[model samples]
Target: MTADLPLRKIIHIDMDAFYAAVEQRDNPAYRGKPVVVGGRPDSRGVVATCSYEARKFGIRSAMASSQAYRLCPQAIFVKPRFEVYRDVSAAIRRIFSDYTELFEPLSLDEAYLDVTVVSRCRGSATLIAKEIKDKIRQQTGLTASTGVSYNKFLAKIASDLDKPDGLCLITPEQGPGFVERLPVGKFHGIGKATEKKMHELDIRSGLDLKRWPLSLLVQHFGKAGQHYYDIARGIDHRPVRNFRPSKSVGVEITYPEDLAEPNLILQQLIDLMGKALARLTAKQMTAHTLTVKIKYHDFVQITRSKTLPQAITGVEGFEAILADLLKDTEVGVKKVRLLGIALSSLHSPELLHYRQTDLFAFSMPSHFPN
Candidate 1:
């Protein structure tokens, strides 16, 4: 609606079926075959990601491994090799830095680049996106989909318009009409629950949402209503930040089979703590809170956390807290599907500046492991 605002050049780069593609690239046998990368089919595992081939049979990420197996019995299921993926992610990030320093990584395989002032490819954001796609293919032997737009929301939407080595763009002039035709559920922050609510209100698309009064939206969704209103009009002013400080670091694992034994769960916690602690130290951060999470076989998840007077800097301190939090849960009594330990209330030299900045604040000031 407003034409006076500065036009920012934003691009969203998403690797095409990242984890599944990596597996296929490294192992030639997986090529042209459906590959699911995550937990095994016999366990309580879920699909992390799947090849487009798997998608033909409706296999998707977060689906139960067993269900995926049932969908396509011939599909090859493999465990995740995060270390290899991490290496590839790092390599791609280095490639991103060559174009512009103003990029935010959403995950290992997805990132948003703000190249409003970038000079590479003669300052053409579209060309920049094309070059990036080419470089990723050359360097990592992987294909990525790129979306070029004036903001993150539209850019991300454009990226998904095409898949598996596709490039799409939505210009400022096209933003309004593009969003109007988009489904409410396809909007970035609108999840399944919100989509259901939108359906009840007949707010099925961006055009439908734009018709509702701001007051009505707020009455229905509280603070999130403002976001809905802004996005409906194709308004998103969020910046592409260069630095993202960690609020916490932790490690977690989902068991192949539900473990009901205290000793086994305890051992898993210990292992998780080691990885968590190592990550915390690697980031030069300290935590004052330790939280233990347990998910039972029935899918009920609970967390117990303790805030210490002093920051924990060693494994022994973390172990003590873990033991206490574990005791607070009914892990041994119920079959546990997943166990996780997290250290929060984090502090580090890198975060100190943001902590002191009055402009910055976390709505939820705690972090959890991915």
Candidate 2:
């Protein structure tokens, strides 16, 4: 575990309404006016991103465009220009690379940088973040929000505290108190379902979560419980790696309407598995862990996973596993809105190395989120 080591400087940078901001920058009319970058208002489309001006009217990303229209009818809705976004993203990446070689891009508009050993800007992570933000504004005519801290979790959270051209810092002295005061739902990995579970147990804030015994959390939340235990105490050890190995690869489909027919659902699963297998083949990797995810009409989601003794490459071998997983779920009895298949514990033959001292090596528990 690296917990005993000295703290490192980590920074998380997220562009402010990246798509919408670009539109506003290119088109002068959108300045100080609400702008939305997404699908048409009349279609069954969702808002991808909206300007801060639009947010005042309660418009938000993922809200149906129709609802966003009802919230602010005059808001300008523009389709996404992914190519332009990619160009701007590359420009930002160049700026980041100048400060630190340790870059872990979370998405096109967000990334993490480890500047613990970086000498640029006099080795000040905060100064590096400011300079990066300034360079982005100068080059792309766009604004970004930045957060600086000793770990990834806090750095990410701080970035959102004051958004739209904001910069915030959470030092080691502030981390514990900041986490304690934060709402339980605000924890990075705790989704709506987990938040409901936490609330059911009278855990509404980080302080409340911290008071619970680690075993109790594990018993209630499975592997995710250990994650909750550590973050509540402001203990996250996840590193910023230049290359993050894909933990799992999968594809999922959400139907417009709930599916009731067993045969139809099986067909969907088969199609999904075919797509997953194709990707696995493309990567030249084999998977030892298979998981099937089901989301009911009411949005209740469950995953059934099975681990094989050895990795397999053929799609025919997964049929039995898929059937068994479906049989264990409530897909047939209840309406299903989504179905997915994921492959994990992957290994590439070319990447595997043998050692005489050990047959295989497992990372310490601290290597993961917990």
Best by TM-score: 1
| Poorest stretch of ten by lDDT in candidate 2 | 355-364
User: Which residue pairs in candidate 2 have backbone atoms (N, alpha carbon, C) closer than 3 angstroms, thus clashing?
Assistant: none
lDDT tens readout by residue for model 1, 286-359: 89888888999998999998888997766554555567778877877899988788999988856654221101
lDDT of 2 by residue, 344-363 (tens): 99887765441111000011
lDDT of 1 at 35: 99
78 in model 1: Cα distance from truth in Å?
Answer: 1.2
- Candidate 1 runs further than 4 Å off: 1-4, 249-302, 306-370
lDDT of each: 0.76, 0.75
Native RMSD of candidate 1 (Å): 8.3
User: Given candidate 2, what's the lDDT at residue 169?
Assistant: 85
